[model samples]
Target: MSPLFPALAARSARPALRFGDQALSHAELATAAGALAARIAGAPRVAVWATPTLGTAVGVVAALLAGVPVVPVNPKTGERELTHIVTDSSPALVLAERGAELPPILAELARLDTDITGSTEVAEATDTVDRALPAEPSPESPALIVYTSGTTGPPKGVVLPRRAVAATLDALEDAWRWTEDDVLVHALPLFHVHGLILGILGPLRRGGSVRHLGRFSTDGVARELSSGATMLFGVPTMYHRIAEALADDPELAKALTGARLLVSGSAALPVHDHERIGAATGRRVIERYGMTETLMNTSVRADGEPRAGTVGVPLAGVGLRLVDEAGAEITAYDGDTVGEIQVRGPNLFTEYLNRPDATEAAFDDGWFRTGDMAIRDPDGYVRIVGRKATDLIKSGGYKIGAGEIENVLLEHPGVREAAVTGEPDEDLGERIVAWVVPVRADAPPSAEELAAHVAAQLASHKRPRTVRYLQALPRNDMGKIMKRALHD
Candidate 1:
């Protein structure tokens, strides 16, 4: 197989990475990553304390170069979550910045401090050490052991093979029309797939350069885009802020309007924000769908219409099918029927590490159960309704998706943020409930007004039976609305 980063060796002084004010040329980053790769070359596995710093990127690239399966641990993880991840993916060494103070949970593991300045202790002997390094890892060899958020139970480690990474990135190349000419920009955390794999490694895979904001700010976005950056990656929260700021900041609107692509993921980007940004800058924010177990399953094509509320067609190699509750596949794409999404492709993870039973149950006839419920339009665009466990609300014998209701509520002038859920009801079996953050706390929209707003947009049956006002909706690090937290 070809190298994941085919251009890393040939680019002489071309910029490859930028964090805040620091930048690295392709040759410089190769030397630094290669120098570190030689140190942990033959280790069983390595854990990276994934901060948004350049060191975290260096450590991850080094591990990939060494063909070592890297476990990227979230730096802000609580004790229990950290312990679970470290214990599950028992790595021989934990990689972190030179002066990083690790938590007590990582005390048992050996540590390796990385120098982003290209001046490691073994810098002098880098050439000699790299000359004798092993060949590229096998396509099927494990590359990453990413853990789930563990919302349901203990977070399971999803083992991703090198083939999965290579296939997904290559597929993205086709879908996004990505090339070395593009300069990617984002401020997503380095710990998750969105930031680490797609945000960082994506640019490297395409031989393009990346400029991480280190921290997300509208000013930083305008600075990079106004200079030379062509693409922006962000979650819903960031784009929402951008939508909010575009009304006041003409520079931000101009910078965004000039960008080649604006992508949003991790959670759904509200149709309201999508329209807001589009009206201000004429740039449609494209959304994609994927998870930790599957790197990427579907995305809106670069050449396709940037439609709101739908995450375009399936990726090149991915085979997608919607399954009913009875395990039957939904064949028709009439654009209204909801079914659970199941996918099969080379982009899928190999297994749930050390969890044989869970892995066995996750697959059915080579297809992995995605647990996400969505509907496909006649044009083949997939619109995710919500998760089956939480987002699918069965009320009055009708299965309602919280996403549709939430989107309608977002369009309401009085509602700033909205989340939909269901509760036990004797009459309807389950009643749809709306949790809303109002634009004006003192004169918030009444439950009847909000319910009417949703009924006018969607069906009356999908309207919320009750509404609860809050200062803000509960969200996770990824900006996903945590409905479970509402009951908790």
Candidate 2:
């Protein structure tokens, strides 16, 4: 396969990236990353303090150019997590923006301050730098070692191969109809796959530009989409904010209406938010399914229907199947029977770094076990309900999906945010519990009322047997509710 960034070396004067007030053209990025790549070349690996800044983008690109695997460290990570990452990855040096304050754990490592501003004297040397860079590494070589959120244990390093990145991006290009003329806009943090790999590298691989909002806000989203951004990428939290603000802000709705594509991922976007946004703006927010181990698997195609609850069909080259608890492949696409989603494709990561046992356990018959429970439509669209471990509730001998209940709960006017989980029950084996943040704390809806509301929408057995109201739901950086924290 060709190099991951062909357009970078093209030296086009077209704008390539924008973060807040800073902007870099394709030529500038190539020069800056190439220069940094020369300095960091031949390192075993490097850690990028992945802040949502121009420097982070350049640093990641530089590491890729030098054929060195890069590990993205979240800036908001606590001391213990940061220490474990540093100790596990054992990067030779840390790449961060100049003068940026780093934590003590990262500060202890050899640091290289990345310069986003390309040297003017290197204007003539852009081509020289490109030529001087190491030959494109083998497609199977490790490109990135991204750490998971470590929900179950200490974060495991997912080693992504160069081909996996290229394959996923190429597949998205086919699915989303993405191209060089498109300019993407988003405000996602750069530490994760959603923000760093897809939000940044996805555009670069297509030779398109991206404008980062630095932080998400209705004002920033409206400004960029209205000005010229063709596409927007965000998680459910950002989209929910847009849905809420559309009624009070006409400009926000109007800006969203003009966009070519609006994509949401990292978590399930509530059907309520989807309907609200579509009703106000005449544009539907597209949701895709992916994780740290798999860069991308399924996406609602740009040319296909933007189904409210479903994640559309698997992308080109991806093989998807549903399996039962006994590990039997569920062959029927009935749209009602739930099963664990298993996928096999080039988009899969090579392995878990230094965890051979864990890596081996993650796959079955060459398929990566996603641990996500979902139902597939006859038409092939996959509707994810929740994680197999947390979202699937067995009540009264009926298996229920928490995501469907959560979506229904969000439709209630009295509810602001909702998460559903199962707890041990003497009668039902596992009783459905609804954790809610109500619209009014003092005058919240009665548990009985909420339960009846759920029963009206879904089956009686799926209704929440117990309701726990809260001021707020605990969410991770990506806006996914930390379901395990609820029990704590």
Candidate 3:
């Protein structure tokens, strides 16, 4: 496939993106990208630290159009994380917002005479002259290198090829029925795959318009939905917060009536939250499954009765299988049997960047081992059990899923958020512990009350032995819970 800028430029006069008060047509966006790309064409890689705005979008697409691999670093990240990403990527150029502090890597780049630009002014160039650059990227050529949340170790860069990105866009377009008329609300952070691939590229591939929200706020998201956004994509936590904020406001609830589709992913959406969102907005939330390594693998249909706990069927061109510990294939129709979830498709990442041994260990034959445990119902819909690495809890000679306990904990009326992990125990080997964020700080439930709450829903061995109150659960930049970090 040709570079994304040229493909988008074909519809130059059409509206491509909308920021706070600025709108850019496809031609204008491409022109701005070309100008920026020209300045950094010789750079091996470019790092960007800006919020999700139209300017950042132009810079990224432009860098790619110029054949420079773009690494999107979160603007809110600390200096240490920023340094690691920039040094590992070895970016020759850095684009940051004016007045934003530069990390040490940028200082090193300056010492090396690399080009680094920072500006608050949005690109105003409307001239349609397209500068010549490498138009065709090889299918295997790395297009973007996104770093994972590093649940196991330090974050490793995940290299995605142009073809893989294109294929994911194609698959999303077909599966989600995205059309040119759809106006998407782009509110998620751009550094993560959910926002970049699902929130941006997925809509743009269908020639849809995107309104980028710099940050997620309940009122801000409500305002965008009220502004006639046809489709919305966000992580589960964002949706849950929005639902909580709008629980008492009927007008705000009415404002969300214009949304045709609401998608939730990145983390599991609690079944209770899903029902609450549907009750408040009168729109069913379609939950999908994906990670940084794969753009999108499966989705619960928008038109169908969305199963509360299932992520539904795999998308077209995506193949999924469940295997036992021995790697033997299991029946997808078994509703109670759980196994490892493996995937294979054109959208899967080629490999983790510079981690050949990890990559070799990641694949079983040709299928990518997702390290996620899942159970498929008789309808072929899959429900994620938990992560294999961090979700196991041992108690009374029995193994339990922390997700199962967390799911039950989230059902409590007083619970706002929940995370479960195993704490060391001499008798049981490992004891189940729950960290809960309560809805009301003044009247938070005690550990005994929470333990009783879980005892009612879970098996005796699966009940949490301890419930700790926390202001918030530890999460990485992508909003995934860091259970190991909590343990530490």
Candidate 4:
């Protein structure tokens, strides 16, 4: 088969994209990508640094069509981070938005006489012929190299193959029931896998249109949803912000009524936010599971009853196996037994780019060790506990998963978002502390009231010993709460 875009081009002639009043048919998108591909034929890699926009979408697909690896950098990434990524994955070409300020790496590229252009205006001088570079890239061939968000050490490059991309699109389409008529509201950042694979490529693969917003704003998203977007994807924080916006203006909630599916990923969706959104908008948030390495593994189905805590079953073509610390498989029927979530499937990444030792350590036997702790129910549903490294909190000689306390805290009416962590204490080994962002500023609940909120839902040991109110919790680009920062 031809590359993803060329294959998509033959399947539909309908509008493939809509960004702020700009709409492009499949034919137009193909033509633009083909022309840009011809221009960058000699380049080895292309980097894009803009928020979600039509041009950003076109540029990314164009680079892939041209047989070049696409590197998407976070807009908030500082000069030091950008420089490291650009230098590590040296690119011959760079496509960015007009007047989009360049990171230090781009400035270095300019000094090195590399080709960089404003994605909005494609040069007319380039060749327009659609050249078939290679129909099937090797399964080991690197199609895209994305750097991790680096919650711990320096971000490592994750090299994924064309086959992995194809697997993800196919699995998502089958699981989510994405169709040609569906229109996705693309507001997530392009640098992350949730946006690149799920937000942009996944929809386009099924001949759907993506309504791109340059940046995520509550008002802007409300306006887009009002226009006519059928599917919407966002992190938990973005959904919380929209929920806040709806409180002030009830009309905004009506705009979201048109959406058939509202997805939350990149982080755990707080149970309080999930239930609040359902009551407010009359739609239950579909929380899915994925990461930088694996594009998408599980989703809370739209047609099925969305469980509050579980992330649902594995997608088609994806196999999930829970194993104990000794590398033995754990049965699904086991009662409340938590183990490491392991996966073996086509959707897994080829390897970490240029890091053989790291790649070797990532897998056990043939299954990729996800490093995430989870429990499988009798029905095969998976509820994530937390990462094995940081999930375990020692409080009063008992080890606890922060997710347990966070989930319970989220049930409170006054709490909008919550993150739980272990703090050093002289009396106990470590005390369970809760940091919360209230739904309303002036309506902040007292610590006693919040503690009561937890006491009503959780056991005595699981309840937090201390509570602190904050305006916002620190988060990475992908929307995962930065629990490590809470200690400081």
Error of 4 at 49 (Å): 2.5
Candidate 4 lDDT for residue 258: 64
**lDDT score, candidate 4:** 0.75
lDDT winner, 1 or 3: 1
Scored against the true structure, residue 460 in model 1 reaches a CA lDDT of: 93
- lDDT at position 19, candidate 2: 94
Q: Across residues 122-202, which tens digit of lDDT does each residue of candidate 3 receive?
A: 233334355454566677777788988665677788888777788877776776777787888858887777887667666
Q: Per-residue lDDT of 1-488 in model 4, one digit per residue for the tens?
A: 54575434573578787777666777667766666666676577778764566667777877777668888877788777777788788877677655566766675563211122433224442344243333445655667888997667667888877778888888877777778778888577888788887788877778778887767887777777787778888888788787667778776788776678888887787776777777788888788887778777887766667877778889888888888778999886553677888887888888877678989999999788988888877878888878877776677766577786788877777887788877778998788788999989798878888777776776677678898889998876667788878777
The Cα error of candidate 2 at residue 485, in Å, is 0.9
* RMSD (CA, Å), each prediction: 1.4, 1.6, 3.2, 3.2
Which residues of candidate 3, in runs, are more than 4 Å off? 2-7, 98-100, 110-134, 394-399, 424-427, 440-452, 455-458
TM-scores, all candidates, are 0.98, 0.97, 0.90, 0.89
Tens digits of per-residue lDDT for model 2 on 323-368?
A: 9999999998898999999999999999999999999999999999
Poorest lDDT segment (10 consecutive residues) of candidate 1: 125-134
lDDT of 1 by residue, 1-488 (tens): 67766656554477888897777777667777777887899898999999898889889988988999999998889998898888888899999988888998786789888757545634654555334334678899998999999989999999999899989988988999999899999999998889999999999888889999999999999999999999999999999999999999999999999999999999899999999999999889998999999999999999999999989999999999999999999998999899999999999999999999999999999999999999999989999999999999999989888898889999999999999999999999999999999999999999999989999999999999999999988898999988999988
